[model samples]
Target: MALDKQDLLFAGLMGSKAVNLIQNANIVNNELINRVLPVIPFLPVKNEKNNVTSKSGHAINAEDNWTTRDSIEDQKQFFPLSFSFKENGQKWLFPYEPMINIASGNSIVKRNVAKQGDKLIGTIKERWSRKDFDITVTGVLIGSIMQGKPEDCFPREHFSKLFEFLKHSKEIFIYCHPLDLISVNKVVVEDYSFPFTKGENVQAYELKLTSDYSYELLIKDDF
Candidate 1:
């Protein structure tokens, strides 16, 4: 079968390579707020929400006050973003998008129900709570300490900020995507380990972050 020019162009558009360039990571220390991370490079981290936790169908009746009372909780819809930065007029893009793994930030809504003799009756109690995020970053770039290599790697000085953040216990706002940012109040380094290979430095990191109280998603034109 012969393909027309329009058909080839349509296929190309469908398979276009999309890139999410990271702009900056916002942070705060003492009086300094919205401080950007010194070391910026492209990282592969997918933004997604974890499975929600909920309880349903306590009672068979749907209309009864005591009927199936379920407490449902879920995180707001947000995308995880890979980090990226430019140095020396060169644009660095991450090859893989799954190297950095972010466990979803969880939030829950509580509900109350009461039942008397199989007929459930209870006043609804509503409450919301936001949880923290457990992030694991593993890739060649994270452990790369080589200087002058801006392609698919980062420097040791840049990685040092992770340790400094742990020591100072500073809070940071991660601009995961252009539309939204992961604002965390406390960043605790849970674990840091890596292996030394022949001419290769590979590292793994575990971090626990406290969720922010509030945030606003802004459009690029408005921001």
Candidate 2:
């Protein structure tokens, strides 16, 4: 007996779902999430096979060997901040003076000095660096409030601040655990691509926040 077209379509859908479930399960079991956590920096390293070993078991290719000097040179700097309700007690103080300028083609730099009264904050210096791709972000955990109240959440205010800061930023970074799944439902930023990198046993995401801020987030494993 021949199966109906609807039945075949339903079977195909079920098969697709099954394949997706298996793929997802494999991803989870392999702990791919830990590799993409935004807070952690991923540095590329030279493979050991490339090393030339002498009779003394010492690597002869010193210049080609992986060293801190080269690693530091290739290092991509990133900064991220987390806010919580417990830290600030109640009030939120957001006194930020951003030095990043996209039009000027300069890297963001910030300096702080103690004063008698309120803190003095402003851009002290701005200059373009050869390492323009290197980015630094500082997140101030501007206290959090109860989630029960709509006003307390300050969703719009928080989004506004993020928008203003990311207006010139190339990317935004986020950190999460393997179990910490995220949804794009309420995210305000637009025009961005997320590239996820996996480690030997974990997963992470490198978010290119263009038209936004670019950053990385590594998903941690449950201990």
Candidate 3:
């Protein structure tokens, strides 16, 4: 069928408009993809709180991780990070966290001996007390040299900060893979030491920590 010039012109205009709309839609989609891609990698870690020994329902958000050294964007995602500590709006992360050894034992009391004169019957199991768990960690503070980074020096800053945690004597919200598996979350640093090691960029340290049980005490009214 033959069409008028006006009809042909109208059709061309409509096609142009449709093309512009499609172009705009593509631009928007690209922008959305760019924004969402970054967030996808940082969408936070799994929710594992079944083993929080400190308090009921204490949360440990693993997404609050960051690297100490700068690297390419592609490598940023690969930067090693293992341990996460968060408490009262403050967070502490080990950029290259490494737990060399983990030792755990429960504090328990088993009363097995009765008085010397008591009946020789099977030992009386009168007293039984199972306290908190003792957690020992042999952690390594990774520095530049280990990753072949620029410098070959120990991570003094991280070491100092870790000691700071021990000195403060505050209960910390800790998230660690091994500890998490056994439902351990909150902990208190009872002791720590930086043992001598032959590493220019790494320092080995030992930590004696105990599982923390948080409690609130009510006080009497004051005038």
Best by TM-score: 3
User: Model 1, which residues run further than 4 Å from truth?
Assistant: 1-115, 121-126, 142-155, 178-200, 214-223
Measured on C-alpha atoms, candidate 2 has an lDDT of 0.28
Better of 1 and 3 by lDDT: 3
Report the alpha-carbon TM-score of model 2 versus the true structure. Answer: 0.19
Total residue pair clashes for candidate 2: 27
Lowest lDDT sum, 10 consecutive residues, model 3, at 51-60
Q: Residue-wise lDDT of candidate 1 within 1-223, one digit each (tens)?
A: 4445533432232222111111111112211111211122122232234222222232322222111101111122123223322112222222222124556654656566645445656544476555666665443223322212333233354346445554544344343442244543223455654433222222333344433344568746754
- What ordering of candidates by lDDT runs from best to worst? 3, 1, 2
Best by lDDT: 3
**Candidate 2: Cα lDDT at 65:** 26
lDDT of 3 by residue, 104-156 (tens): 54444445664646456555565555567787665456543222332323576
lDDT-best of 2 and 3: 3
Report the C-alpha lDDT of model 2 over 1-223, residue by residue, as the tens digit.
Answer: 3445433432332333324344334444333223211111123444555332222113233443222111111022221122223323332222221111121144556554456255545545554443222222222111122122333322345444444534533323322121023221111223322122222211111212222223568877899
* Residue 38 displacement (Å), model 1: 22
Question: RMSD to native for every prediction?
Answer: 24.8, 25.7, 24.1
lDDT of 3 at 119: 52
Q: Work out candidate 2's RMSD over C-alphas.
A: 25.7
